[model samples]
Target: MVSPSPELALHGLVLLGTDTVYAVHMPTFTAPHDFQAVLRVTLDTDTYRTARKRYGTSALFTARPRTLLLKDLQPGATCPADLYFGRFGRDGEPLGEVSITIEETVYVGHPAAEPRTLRYVLFGREQLYLSHVLTRPPDFDQVVTAQLAGEWWASGSGAETPARTVTVPDRPDDLTGRLRPGEQLTADGTQLQVLAEVYLETADLAAGGV
Candidate 1:
C-alpha cells in the first residue's frame, strides 16, 4: 500500500501554445485517513483557432512551442506543468528530485469541425531515492489521480461546460466524488454525476513513476 505523508502529493500541468490551454492539479482536501486530488483544464478560444489554422485537420493536437506558466502552484493549487517529485523525510528533508520528458502529436480539422479523434500518450517516470531518514524502506506504492478538460476548437460546439462546479468527496473512496479519466462524469446542464470510473493508474509512484 502507498504510504501516506504530507509530501507524497504530486501535481502536473500542460499548456498548448496555440490555445491558452491551462491544466492544473489541486489537492482539495487531506487528512490522516485520506486525500483528494482534482485536475482541471481550460482552453482559450482565440489560441485554439490559431492552432487549427497552423495544424491541418486531423484527429489529434500536436505539441508546439508555447509559453507555459505556473500559476499559484502551491502544494495543491493545481497540477504543475513541470513535474516536480521529491522524497522528503517526515521532517521535510529533500531525498530525491523530479523531471519530465514529453512526446506529443497533434491532429487538426476544419474551422467548424471537430477532429474525429484526438489522442495523446505521455510516457515517462519520476525517480525518488529514499534517504535513510525515511521511516521505512520505500515500499513502492503511491496513488495519483488526474483530471482533464479542454474547450472545443470550434465555437458553439457545446463540447464542454462553459463553467463547471465539481464537488469532490472528503474521503478518497466516497461514492460521491469528482470526475476522473476514463470515468464518464458529466453535468447535463443541471446536476453533475459520475457516469463511470475510467480513470486508470497512469503512473507508478514507487518503482518507476509514470
Candidate 2:
C-alpha cells in the first residue's frame, strides 16, 4: 500500500529597503488520494533593521503579481509547469503579464516492480513561457510585456546565500531585560498568499494493465 502523505513547508525571506517580503509554502496532505497547497506572502517592517543589516539597505519592494501558488504532486514527482502574473490598471483593465515556465518529471514506484514505478514527463512548460512572453504578454498585459520570454525554475536544492542570524540587543540597566523591537509593516498594506496542490492517481497504472 502507498505510504501516508507527508507535510512540507518552505519559507524564504526577501528584503526590500522599506519593505520585506516573506514567502511561505505549506502543504497538508489530507487523504491518501487528496492534497492541498498553501502559499502566503507577508510584509514586515519591524524586520527592517535586520534586513538592512543583512542586505545593506532599508527600502525593499515587490514589483507586481503580488501572490502565486502551485500545488499537488507525489513526493518524488516532477512536472512541467507554467505560471503567469498579470497587472491591472486602476480602471480594472489589463495592464501587462509576466510568466515563468518549468519542465518537470515525476517518478513513482510500481508496486509489482518492487523498486520502480512510472514517470510522467512533459515539454509544454518551455513553450508556454515563450508563447506568453512573445505573444500573450503583449496582447494581454503591457506591464509585464517586457518580461515575457524568460526561463525560470521552481523549488529545488541549489546554491543559496546562508541565512544570517541576529541577536536582540540588551541594555545595561534593564531589570526586565527587554530588548527594543523594530518596526513591522505590511507589503502594499496587504497580505499576499499563494497555494498549489497535486494528487497522484496510483491505481491508474494497474487499471491500465501497465
Candidate 3:
C-alpha cells in the first residue's frame, strides 16, 4: 500500500514591481487550530482581494512590500507615490525580514453578513460634486456641510465633494436624519434632489450608478 503524501512546507517569493503586494497569515475564524495564509495579489498591480489557504503544521514563508503607492490615492487625484521593498539584486543582498505565526488559541465567532450602506452622491453641471453616506443620526447641535473639497477631471464623471452651503428642509429647525431619497437639498445655490441610484454615462467613469 502507498503511504499518504507528506505535507510540505510553504515557500514563496514576493517580487518587486510585480502584483504580489501584501501577504498575511492568521487563524481561521471557525477553527482556531487550523491557520490560514492570505496573499493580497492584484491584477493591475493594485492592492485588492486576498488569496487564502489553510496550512496545518508546516513552515510557511511570506513577504510583503514595506510601502504602498495607492495608500492615499483617490478617484481623481494624485498622491505622493513612493515604494520601499528593501535591497535587491546580487548575491548576499538582504531582501527584507518577515516572521508570521499565530499565538492565540481563541476562535472568534464568524461575522454576520450585514448589508452595505448606500451613499448619496451629488454632482454639479461640470465635474464638481458632493456626497453623503450618513449611517447614524446627527446630534442636536450638529450641522452638516458639503465636507471636504477636491477636483474631478472628467466632463460629466464623478468628482470629490467640495465645501458648500448644504441644507435640508427646515434648516436648523429640522434634524439631518429627516433627509431621505427624492428629498431636495440646496447645495451652493443649486437644487439637487437625492435619488436611489444616479448613473453618469462616460468612458472615464463606470456606467453603473455611482
Per-model lDDT: 0.23, 0.20, 0.25
lDDT of 3 at 88: 22
Ranking by TM-score: 1, 3, 2
- Candidate 3: clashing pairs of residues: none
Best by lDDT: 3
Off by over 4 Å in 2: 1-59, 64-67, 72-96, 100-161, 171-210
lDDT by residue (1-210, candidate 3, tens digit) is 111122211222222112122222111122221121222222332321122112111112223333222221112312121121321221223323433222221111111223323223232322223323222222111111121223223333333233222444334322334334445566445565443221111121111111
Model 1 residue runs over 4 Å out of place are 1-10, 26-162, 166-186, 190-210
TM-score of 3: 0.23
- Collision count for each candidate, in order: 17, 36, 0
lDDT of 1 by residue, 67-180 (tens): 223232233332212221111111222212222222211111111122211111111111000000001111111122222323212433334322222223232321123233
Best by TM-score: 1
Residues 10-29 of candidate 2: C-alpha lDDT, one tens digit per residue: 11111121222221111112
